[model samples]
Target: MGMEQQAVEIVETNKPVILQGGCLCGAVRYQLSAKPFDADYCHCKQCQKSSGAVFQVWMDFKREQVTWLKGEVSEFESSDNVRRGFCKQCGCTLSYRDTRYPDYFTLTIGSLDEPSLIKPNYHIYTSNQVKWLSITDDCERYQQERTS
Candidate 1:
């Protein structure tokens, strides 16, 4: 089953879901009150550089749904209006935020305490994907950002 289905099953359980996670050094911790949405594998150049990976899995949540339980993430503007968050202690990429979407916050799936609980539903920015890497998933592929 997909991550979306898994998340739905979790929510349907009627239990209070408090998803928790942190940075590599355990210095930056967070909790999510609600399940995340728009989970995808991003192949944008910025994502690749920031994550030091061919692609990065990210999921979006309403800003209010997330609470910092421990140290806060240090952010750097990756582009004109886009900011990326990371732990200062261990430099683990944590989040991505765009000024255009002030109400939404995006988190790296690798930062989650249970990364297996979520999965990428699609692939974005395929135009920038590495030539050596091959994506064999059946998920939708977008050359750029997925237009709703």
Candidate 2:
């Protein structure tokens, strides 16, 4: 239910491994390649408003592993070719896709049963960071978007 710090077993080698995820209602299910890359947290207003929480965690993985398990997902065109996929029943975000990055899909890290395996590597939208919530000096903080 909260951010995990414990590591999950690495079920595979460098080769593609099955990674599982689904919505809160379990209506929409998906699988992605294991060994996610560039796991991070977003603090942008749109993300805060969309999640209605402190922040959103995301893990980048190859898109080929993602698929609809049970039913269809409602999509919102969040950005250029980037569609936000969520379950119609639970209204839980499943993943985000962009044809530009068709090879990589950014999956919600919070959706993972083992979020501990993935930790926030960077913080985005530090310029809009809440005054009451201070950013730790340990990790990189970008005032705006950091492509790198």
Best by lDDT: 1
The 10-residue segment of model 1 with minimum total lDDT is 1-10
Model 1, CA-based lDDT: 0.85
Q: Candidate 2, residues 1-148: lDDT per residue as tens digits?
A: 1233223334335654456777888887766656665666778886776677767777776566566567777888886777887888989986767777667777787776555556666787877676788766466677887755
Indicate the residue-level lDDT of 109 in model 1: 82
lDDT of all predictions, in order shown?
A: 0.85, 0.69
lDDT of 1 by residue, 36-68 (tens): 866888999999999999999987888999999
lDDT, candidate 1, at 122: 82
**Candidate 2 lDDT:** 0.69
Report the C-alpha displacement of residue 83, candidate 1, in angstroms.
0.5
RMSD of each: 4.5, 6.6
